[model samples]
Target: MECERKYRSRALYKACMRAFDTLPVCALVDSRFLCMHGGLSPNIRIISDIEKLDRFVETPDSGPLCDLLWSDPSENFDDIDDQQPEFKPNNVRGCAHFFSYYACRDFLLRNNLVSIIRGHEVQKNGVRFFRKSSRTKFPVLISLFSAPNYCDTYNNIAAILKIDDHQQLSVVNIEAHAHPFVLPNFENGFQFGERFVLYHVTNLLLSIFNMYSPEELAAEDGRHDKTGVELLNKKRLIGTMDRAYAELKKINKITLNLRGLTPSYSAYKELLTRPEIKALVNEAEKGRITSFDQAIQLDHIFERRPHT
Candidate 1:
């Protein structure tokens, strides 16, 4: 509600909500394929069973409705045998069940359906086909993801499923097109203004501090001698400040490069674990690697070398 008030009109928000209210949770196409946002529910054995669900209210935390919205196809479908149960608790998601190949096969056979089409998981090629068995003529389940370059980081292809009158399925793949870059986290005008003010204020204070000469600083310290130990100490302090400023600039550049290359904090930490990256970090700490470009070149050299 806060986000809607900030960026969208109340009327538009209401219209969108009304449209969602009318949309069906699942669809049967050509009386052969079942299409839904997520996979099947353990409680729903037939198509009529889904039709009888009370979907008008908010989806409950657990039950047939929640499972229909949140359940996923099991990753170990190939390993599942005929004797194993069709559905198991989804440990990864912690709410719904994981439907295996056997479950999907049983559902299709029970409903007199050819295939189940769902869109709960992202696919690298935008589509995935799961066969019921090694000798099955057609895939029992088809997972289609129409978002290319998902989250602007996965570099995945988008695809659409085309079902002809004969019930034959074909996939059309699409590559991500170039688009204008935007800052992450949907930064608002107020946030940008705050950052601008803080940056300038910090720079202004640093400039004022740097304006003081060594002699002036020593004088301010109540040391009147021009060539005394106080003057030497002040000189050393100035040199230390210069070194610190240089190091800060280098760190800022590296941080920008890392942000551009790594999409998330987990990925950044994983990159740090690489031997080349670790070596670069050690050099950076010792003030040896001064630029991100130098670090990139060293990383490339490590990439080209064969592993022992």
Candidate 2:
């Protein structure tokens, strides 16, 4: 009612939708880092395979599209073995195979790439790096989560990685603010345990953003604020989607452990059916918005000049 009255044809809404039509699922930076939300898939042999995909359409139920949008890094020891294939069914989220160290190495070597920088997991420290192996000389996979104090409970800091023309990397951690209202109007509906699980699940699925730390990243390059913050916004859309998928994997683990609270697979299945969850997935598919409140908070965080 309000939308139609505010704009007879919903011009603002339509304009935003069209803006989303131009986005790609992933991007390559200086041909060094494979920047994607989720981890690699068995079906995706080459990066160009992504370009071959038809864009601006509803993501199909299964295929490289679903895997790219939904997969996560495999933590299972059996799957991470270098001698064995790094691909295994991801029982956690129930879609997209879990990728191991060997799998990531193959992808990078085949694609002639360096690191796979993905933002799909909530690290207690804001950012996490998974090396090729305990014996590897350098890190090959970087998992970045830019939401500080995740869900107003995790107390986690948020960070962003900056790679300059020279291919140097730096992570800037944002201090989590005190947000009393985590999910507005949504928490009051469920029971205690249900709400507890739901909040964490929602937190896992929603990826709030952070202000960039050019100074933090500039220690190596000495290039200060030359690249305006506008460039950072471009990465936020894809990064947030990646983080949301990673968080979903976390929710699955949490529910599995708290089986008394949630009915394992049934609990996750129920979660998928949630109207709130559905709206989130839809927006992620559209790549439009993450969270209205968090969006405003991010604007405020960046708008204020950072204190030196």
Best lDDT among the predictions, by candidate number: 1
How accurate locally, in lDDT, is each candidate? 0.68, 0.60
Best model per TM-score:
1
Stretches off by above 4 angstroms in model 1 are: 1-7, 133-136, 193-308
What TM-score would candidate 1 get against the native? Answer: 0.66
Q: Which RMSD does model 2 reach against the true structure?
A: 24.7
Model 2 accuracy (lDDT, Cα): 0.60
Candidate 1 collision pairs: none
How far out, in Å, is residue 92 in model 2? 1.4
Per-model TM-score on C-alpha atoms: 0.66, 0.54
Clashes of each: 0, 0
